[model samples]
Target: MRSKPLLRVRKTGALMVAAVIAFVCAVPLAGAMWQLTPVLLIPVVVFVWAWRAGTDVYADELRVRALVGSTRVPWQRVSELAPDAGGQISALLDNGNVIRLTGVTSDNLPRVLAAGGQQIGHSDQPPS
Candidate 1:
């Protein structure tokens, strides 16, 4: 059995609500023609993506899940956690690859670090 995650960060529940609304709106278009029924798949896909895609932080690794696949990054491979100007967080790896952490924002980074038993440090001066 797998151990419980230290943190499971998911997209906002509001996306699920939006997906429902989109599905409801698409019903009319889908009803217009049997051929158009496939239109309904759009919202279903979005709903499933919103429901399944996220980051699960374990003690030994970080599992980043998408609609179709997931990538596992061992903690030792992560060199740094950096946030972009948009406030989305990504992990810079020891080998120089970067992996965006789904649903992790600058605001919640401290919480994530804490859950992973990591420390947070800031530089007083701006980076050159």
Candidate 2:
């Protein structure tokens, strides 16, 4: 079967919070007669960060393109799949790298695990 995205989620709350903090930080500088050019980048950075927070897991490849960078793991390289207590699903690779999937829903977790050719375990927590 072709790999498909089981879930897509962004950190909207965190982004908004970051934007607010950036704005607040800029206000003081703006009042001090200082240019707020640097501060303006904060909101943009926050937006980019939020936009990249989404996770994608497919049958043949598991990809995560977050603030750090993007990684594509072929199914054959996946050693195990585990869900943490916080509802984040982690794909453990044969190379010992773990890609955590956030913002996944309970309904989609089953399909993702199945696509990865792994069975869900008792400790597996449904995605949030």
Candidate 3:
């Protein structure tokens, strides 16, 4: 059986800020004047964020869908995977490409390391 990659789900700060702004803006329309059209955009944005956060990074391929665009990176090109203090994971490519995994948890870190063919004791700090 093929080993599935680690999946990370993280909330984007920008999305949270946007939701707050949308909520504030929709306050005035909260009464009988409320319509799902204007406020509906917030849910759409949240859904998009949720989808992006729940991306999977496997040994065979890296899949990402974010603000810029969607991309796939094969395992052969992946160089490194590291985690930052701010709780973000960075995937380094042999071609000098770096993709940040926004919502990576400790639980999922092991799977990511395994997919990358890296041992657990390879890092002094923590794996990305």
Candidate 2 worst ten-residue window by lDDT: 2-11
Most TM-score-accurate candidate: 1
Q: What is the lDDT of residue 62 in candidate 1?
A: 88
- Among residues 3 or more apart in sequence or in different chains, the pairs in candidate 1 whose N, CA or C atoms overlap within 3 Å are none
Backbone-clash count (model 1): 0
* Candidate 2: segments with Cα more than 4 A from true spot: 1-7, 13-32, 105-108, 114-128
**lDDT per residue as tens, model 3, 1-128:** 64655654456567767766776666666544666546756655665665555445665676665744667777677677777776567778998979776565565777766755656655587757
State model 3's lDDT.
0.65
Per-model TM values vs. the true structure: 0.92, 0.61, 0.59
Q: What lDDT score belongs to each candidate, Candidate 1 first? A: 0.92, 0.69, 0.65
- The better candidate by lDDT, 2 or 3, is 2
Minimal lDDT window, size 10, model 3 = 2-11
Candidate order by decreasing lDDT: 1, 2, 3
Against the correct fold, how does model 1 do in TM-score?
Answer: 0.92
Q: For residues 9-118, could you state the per-residue lDDT of candidate 2 as single tens digits?
A: 55557677777788777777867766756776777677667777666766567677777787777878877767787766777889998877655545467766675556
